[model samples]
Target: MGAECCNKDCLKPSVIGYGVVAWLSSGAALGVGIWMLVEKSTYSALLASLFYPVTIYILIAAGTFGFIFAVFGCAGAMTDSRCMLALFWITSFVVFAALGSTGFLALYYHDNVLRKDINIRQAINESETNGLKDVINMLQAEVSDKLTFCLLMLSFLS
Candidate 1:
């Protein structure tokens, strides 16, 4: 079925649909990433002092890759290049897997920090030697704030 798709002059609706969806989603992802990076630019220098620059570089790379892959998807669909399509599938799977694992970790950390028994605020106040406690407190506050904001927006929509 896959091989036959390459030879057919008449492209099926499904093929066109897939190409369109891939292109649109990739573009959206790229736009959102850049927008976020730009919006946070004012605080980036301060953030760099406290955190590694690797995450900043990774976000830029991911956005660029998404834009490039969207173009590849459209071209591959138009030209019916099996190799391009295969590469797209492979990369997409890897991206999805990475995102899934990151999401799991985020949720796990969020739950741990929110547990009533964990006195995060107290830990931050008491710890002097390890700076990691401060980082943990910040992460917890950020994640909890974002989650609460999102829920409020969702509730309004519903």
Candidate 2:
């Protein structure tokens, strides 16, 4: 089928290019998701909600969709099927838009949280409950100082 389609000039050069990009990018995303799952799974178990299960799920979902779309895109290109290509375009657009929105919201919330006059550690320390106090202390100790510094710089620049 692919040979017939190729011989008949059914697949455009642009379609092939798009298919290649989809395959490469999807493969890369899948690799990253697996890496994150391995690297962060321990922290996820230790901190539960604070460790960001939602974020981890999103990463995995992104990779899964990427792989799915890549396969669809390649099949569409190979068989010269308009339906598959259309589905790929629509799904990929939606995925990109969702990721973009999530990223923007994360940055916005982080900046808002850090803009408060009181320091996070100070607030955590002054809280009345001992249970939360211990968790917050653990979180503070585990978090990288460089990440905080980077966020501060970003907030200041903006």
Candidate 3:
């Protein structure tokens, strides 16, 4: 009889298999995140948004779910929990499928091209607000980076 220690042994009959699962799942998720962030350069929250169609970017949104699955599956694998792995796998599949289907639906609803209509008044407001957000994020990142570097330098000097 297998000893059940906090549901640990119940998770994987094979520790080796669990390790493999975690590695592969985590690797796949890394690839997905890289493709989305690096290849597509979605560095900003506005660009990171999943609510919009991938057609808006036309490069990397297609694989976003794969990365999510990989990441979640990797975590599950690390934890040796069958539940998390299954949850992430199924959810990732559903999300990917939905994104693909939604892309098609957009073809009909938006007539195959993102509408370019603009309300001048709204445009002005949006431009103003978005600009401030962009500036804030940039400044925050810069400040954070500087702080980290200074701390590292201080540590080395010490």
- What TM-score does each of the candidates earn? 0.49, 0.55, 0.29
Q: Sort every candidate by lDDT, greatest first.
A: 2, 1, 3
Q: Which is the winner by TM-score between candidate 1 and candidate 3? A: 1
Q: What is the TM-score (0 to 1) of candidate 1?
A: 0.49
Estimate, for each residue in 6-33, the C-alpha lDDT of model 1 and write its tens digit.
7555463555566567666656655765
Clashes in candidate 3: how many? 0
lDDT of each: 0.58, 0.67, 0.54
Q: Poorest 10 consecutive residues of model 2 by lDDT?
A: 42-51
lDDT of 2 by residue, 69-141 (tens): 8788878878889899898888888767655664765576575545532354465568777554665556577
Ranking by TM-score: 2, 1, 3
Better of 2 and 3 by lDDT: 2
Among these predicted structures, which one has the highest TM-score?
2
Q: lDDT for model 1, on a 0 to 1 scale?
A: 0.58
Q: List where candidate 3 sits over 4 angstroms from the true fold.
A: 1-69, 109-158
